[model samples]
Target: MAYDADTSIDLTQYRSLIDLIESSAKRYGDKTAYVCLGKATSFNEIERDSRYFAAYLQHHTELQVGDRIAIQLPNITQFVIAAYGAIRAGLVLVNTNPLYTERELIHQFNDSGAKALVVLSDLLPTLNNVVASTQLKTVITTHALDLIAPQPQSQCEFTTITFTKVLAEGSCLAFTPVSAKLEDLAALQYTGGTTGLSKGAMLSHRNLIANAMQIKSRLSDRLVQGEEIFVAPLPVYHIYAFMVNLVLYFERGGCSVLIPNPRDIASLIKTLSEHPFTGFAGLNTLFVGLCHQPEFKSLNFSHLKVTISGGTALTQAAANVWQATTGCTISEGYGLSETSPVVSLNAPGLEQLGTIGKPVIETQVKILDLNDQEVPPGETGELAVKGPQVMSGYWNKPQETAMVMTQDGYFKTGDIAIATEDGFHKIVDRKKDMIIVSGFNVYPNEVEEVLSAHKEILECAVIGVEHEHSGEAVKAVIVLSSLSQDLEQTKADILRYCREQLTAYKVPKIIEFMESLPKSTVGKILRRELRN
Candidate 1:
């Protein structure tokens, strides 16, 4: 079923991601596509640069058709180029967090078996420690100058180079053009597991393209092609922001105001004031942070048409505050890593407070009980989704893949929700023990498993706590068999170990000691009791 419109085309019909970028460039060549700092990048430049990067990859490196290429950069121009370059060069793209520790980086690099990596220069120290252990053969590094123009002084002291200089070291090899099908693998998005492991979700080109088109089609009414500006504060490595900010932005030829560091409210607010943004995509924490800042009240949001909230449940208080201040509600949505990150969203025009709107085009959503039977409307049950955006499966994990993927192709989202009579769905809670800190998933089991290895801890349980900015923060409750003289130092040591092992978001912000954790008669730890 192809959606027909005079100006809109089915984005999934394209064979490669580059095809959409190329077509949009031709249609809106002179229009600004992205803005950073004070400078703007036109669609023509984005197209030309991505093409050059693709040609460079084909010229250098043994990257062949269907090979996986890792992109480990921040929200910079090189990221977009490397992403489209690999896809156009017929290579599967592997998205990695730029702040990953050596252990985290090595796991994803080795698991994906990617042959090449494109990284930012300042993050080289982290990558340098791990690349030796992976099967990666080529490395491409970019400087800050590659993305933003020269600064008056070094606000950030990080080493990086242009892609031209990095590619000069290797001999260029012939790469196949866009010959892969839309159903072929395009990305391997690695998500943290329930069992304290990370597994890559294989998202095909069709999966991503379908999501982009579906989102674009829905927003097409209010969104004017080549005239709208999208605030991309969320990282593109995350699928929710990637589809809306990166993929859909390109599809509609809209300008993306890139926020390099969203954690810094001052800088993010400065960017918001610098541009005439029409659409803003972020989670609850970002909005809460914006409202907390003293200068936030003065920021102009009259041009803004929509605010998309995902990555976690948005509270009624946060939504009400944003609406009162900006005259626009933060539209909440629901998804998981396996569903290309977006299965349902509250359409901008039909947004309902506290609900993750309706299902997008060509998508089916259902609420099922423990017996897989459909639950009545307004009844709490597990949310299951079937759509083109659903991932193929977990990479190389058939047993794990079969566990989540239903026989009829629906992906179990592991989120407890209820559909209202009006067709809007609200998330009651998560069935999995995953903590969302500042819109990033922090698996408590993984944190607890790491804390248990501490010499001072006999057993530990990690849970989420109400946070002002992060929405939810990791808190560790531990049982110590032996009491040490320096308990404070021991707690510090435990946190330090977790920082070294896990991502910063997964680290525990609060550490509390307990005699023993409440458990069921069968010896299963009661996480619900910990929440109380």
Candidate 2:
């Protein structure tokens, strides 16, 4: 509704994401493309290194054009090189979380059927036990300082080669050009499902390119070509950052200052002080955590013009504190992994607080009732979106895909929303039992499955509780077995076991023991009663 038919754009210029990468390299060769751990990698360097990495994947490995390559590293320069190279080699990028447990890694790797993996060196000890269980054949490891200088190599059953070595070997080999069509799969981004395990959302080059262009067009007034510097604290593996930092900012010739660990608030604040960033991307907790630090408030805010918020709903508390500190208004956006992540973002100046502003250009969003018909104006209902940025469907799961998609083309986002009379959309509640901790989606069933496996626990129900630090924290209520000994000790043991199976964000922060969990007459656990 924002743009008319006359302003509608076509995708004739850029063939694929590769075109955007090469175009930026040529335009801003000497400009900084990415900065990580005090080192700046220019656009030309990214181009050359990515080309080398792609060459090795093409000539050295036994990988085909459409094979999946998993990348499990924090926000580092290697992530950019590896992601770009994998795409250039005509392979589908499977962006993996660096903090994923062995169980998670096994499910994702086997689900995506990834043949190769590029992981952090420190994680090799963990991956050492897991790689043999998956379909991964080639494992390339890299340290944080690998690009700056060769770091000591760590060994594992499969992770014997370093990322540096691949680049060097690739430089010698004659590189063959691999062209991927826009309709081809670019990445398999995994998102938490209602089921215990997660599923991969198949995204095409067109889906990504369209979203990037759509957001860019929306924020055209704020972003300046070759001048903007976007501080990226969120994980690059996530679709939100992947679309914003990797595609949008990179194509616009903006430098992304990568923060490896956002949990380390001091280090994150220090990184901010070093760069005269023009833009920032973060979630509610990150915004609140950074604002609480004394070192953060004193930083220069003159250069900061736009602050983008996604991942979780932006709390009014976070928005107020961030604006009071950075002197920049927070533009909160609403999206899901199935939508290449951004459907609506608050407009730059006309931002209406407590609302996700308006839908981006070429995006159609409407609320649907229980009968799948359009809800009355200003009435809360399920939000369904029809957009070019929307993912084709969930990978390799026809039934799951059919469940979310409508008869027409709209993808039914499992969140309750209300459309304002003035064209703004506001999300009110989640239709699914998903818990959002910090910016990550944690499913109740996923955590409950892990807790149920513990010998000490009989039955468990996981629910989201309001957390001051993380937007919401996972709270597990359990009905202990008769065999259980000390209640407190059992709680500790169950939590310890959960940490081993689930990621840090997915683990239950609070555990409660009760005689029995609240359930209905049919014996189904009532999670709402637990939350109450």
Candidate 3:
């Protein structure tokens, strides 16, 4: 395959993701592809296992081509196997958050109409309660250490199979080939919607393939194929990590060490000490958290060359601390799930500290004003994007898809940004009332909807408040059904109620009680007034 200088990608290289995977496996057969929990899987081994998984889906299940399969696992070896296998089996992948509540799970599963679920064994109990409510027909579960060590057999009420058993059974079946086109839907990536329900971004094989190529073009000079080792702590289910680790790094014949739980700084630092990692992908809060630890500062940084930040803004304090501690500079990028997650990234050695750097090759980015007209350079406006990597549209929701796209074919990102004369882009503000805490997006509507479900809550509004730790913290203004003299106890009770229904980041950090929430003439809660 030849690299195109004009478009920045060689479209003649491969047809689909399967083509890329098969070619890389053959090119780097004996090379280590992924390492997790002290176990390394080579490219050949990954190819074989994924083929066996595809065989199982073809012969055992009633699922047909184009059916959706939901994968609800964290960073693990099985996640890679299941995702690739699903694609190979001609099924669409739906990446599900493992931390999602039952209500969230129900909406995503039902909305996507996923026919099969590949999930962690620990989450099977949660799945058990919701599987009956979904369209799931086949359930495969695996332990975190299933690939590394043997586990005692556990019983379940549902008709479920263990991950190891599936692999063993699949090996007996003959694999069949299926034709998939670049325009075929590969995955349904769910993102927070303005209407309070999560919507699936219909990402095609071309979108994923194009984004991978664009990233490669941007960082080709720094990346050495078959030689680089990446420390992947961010969840692979997210599009940012998914494209960088599973797609780009895999295509480059590089090895990625997956961290199942990145919240454990002690464990993460210990893992870092064991490898001569050449690349690392993280965010602002993660960089700050790890750099502040003495154990992390003691690790060897001689082999570290690339440190990419995305999913949220990177603070200068975090960047400076990281550079001073590890002798490696942080390169921040910007994108959303709708764009296969990367629109622009700062190239190493030419990074601009607070800017997102230049747009990727073949991608068009513009700032548009309220009237959908292109804004002048240096003026803040809604950032819009047009590229092959952008999603076709939201799944099963044409109206919602039409709402985000303009007549000119650009996807309107609800973010305010300014383009510098030098071609760098800087984010100024967000057009939506969404809070980003530690790189995770927390939608106010979702939080407020969950909080309003509490029996004692009469009305509530959620707002983003500035925080020293997380970029923003969720704050709730509430008007109770009945006036309570014990305000402190009532606040505690409401918080306790929230933890059950919402994820930790989505839960409000501070709660204030008001006699009545401020409303507009139209009778809607004025969140801007609450923010003031």
Candidate 4:
């Protein structure tokens, strides 16, 4: 099939995600769209369910168009329904992390001013505790098996409804169409803030649609619409997976096998064994972990064609192991939550092992020095991007948005990279202090804030250190309140406190107690000094 660069996949044809979904569902009605826990949902089924959920929002709730609704669930069939339904109803989707602590949850919900939330039943207790802190008017919950099988009725203290109940009730109600333009805000993808808070990246419909089209164009030669099956272990809430599996692949009429918990290597391997997946989306740590599993290595790789590596840098060791085990080369890409998550991806069979391949279609990448002047090719500098897929700005944060955007309209990526003479881009280092653990962003300020809040701790500093398993591990240097004879027990106490407050990955793996941390004249703890 000869792919047309201009008209093969026109992104401008769809104004919103609803338009995209409606067209795709109509085109591939009977094709399987998503599979989770042995239950497969066809394209038509996803469309119907998403419409029902949207109707429920329209009739059952007071939420107006463009209102933010938080979705905090793991990768499941319910997540897909909730996301598409929220977007279709003209609501701004807030992709919440399911593992967020109460403090993190409070900040995001309050910051986004989410009027509604669709969360997992398992996380109801956590939501219950924090519901009073937000402006949420409605709460809907669903279990992992809710779509697969019937569940017994359960009641909650707050006014909450079940996911099935919404679908049932909304099926009978009329779905009033909401006019969402391409320039309308679609999702508020929150990125880690250096100020110890998370800021939402305002992604418009055009931003998402354009990136999906850009990604589709890059992989058009390898991907067969309605024929490819993708193994999506990464959380759909993350932009990388959201754009690839949910938007791009979904529009391509591909089947996505959702692994709710990829951390469970045994279950992940078991899931992979059942499907002859042609595509896999993952990162360096996940790639290394899966390739190390003997059972994973034994799985059928005859059908696997493209395996994508993103979120963090792909090490040569991981790439070698994955190719040796699966017979599929890792196509590493680079992007941020601000860029609708994809600036460039490696061309499917012609992947350069270490570098994130050339910039995707309609995307411009430039390496600039401190003076904002473009550097010579092959020289290291800050990578700046300009494309239709770039986010408009941070949600409700003008000053922060101004800080990231250049006068000439490029978004500063904060990553140091070198554009090769061969057109490939290689990431040299991160200009920011953000730590990536298993492809999840972990900022030192957020972790340090939680640690310093402990009554037993006087002060602390956090930094990313190289690790064999996770690409980077959070390492903490602490200054104790007082001299303690039992330093080991004190360290244990501090870690226990962190576990209660911070997420699992943000908790420090290595803790070192010191009299004082290296600091500048202003008393700001030098994280780079700590890293060294």
Candidate-wise lDDT, in order: 0.79, 0.89, 0.90, 0.89
Q: How far is candidate 3 from the true structure (C-alpha RMSD, Å)?
A: 2.0
The candidate, 1 or 3, that scores higher on TM-score is 3
lDDT (Cα, tens digit) per residue for candidate 1, span 1-532: 1221223336445766667767787888888888876668888877766666777777766778888998887777668867877777788988999888888888899899998988776777676567678888777777656655432222222333457554333224333456777778989998989987789999987888888776776555757777889988888888877787768888877888877788788888888888878898877767776887878779888988888888878788888888888888676877777888777777675678788887777889888888777888779998889888889899999999988866777788888988888777888888668888887888877788778887888988999998876778899999997877887998888888988988888889999988889999998889889998
State model 3's lDDT.
Answer: 0.90
Off by over 4 Å in 4: 1-9, 152-156
Question: Residue-wise lDDT of candidate 3 within 369-464, one digit each (tens)?
Answer: 998899876789999999999999999999999989999999999999999888899998875698898888888888888888888899999999
**Deviation in angstroms for 89 in model 4?**
0.9
lDDT of 1 at 428: 86
Q: For model 4, name the residue pairs that clash.
A: none
Candidate 4 yields a Cα-based lDDT of: 0.89
Q: Indicate which candidate wins on lDDT.
A: 3
Task: Report the C-alpha displacement of residue 253, candidate 2, in angstroms.
Answer: 0.8
Model 2, which residues run further than 4 Å from truth? 1-6
In candidate 2, residue 106 scores what lDDT?
94
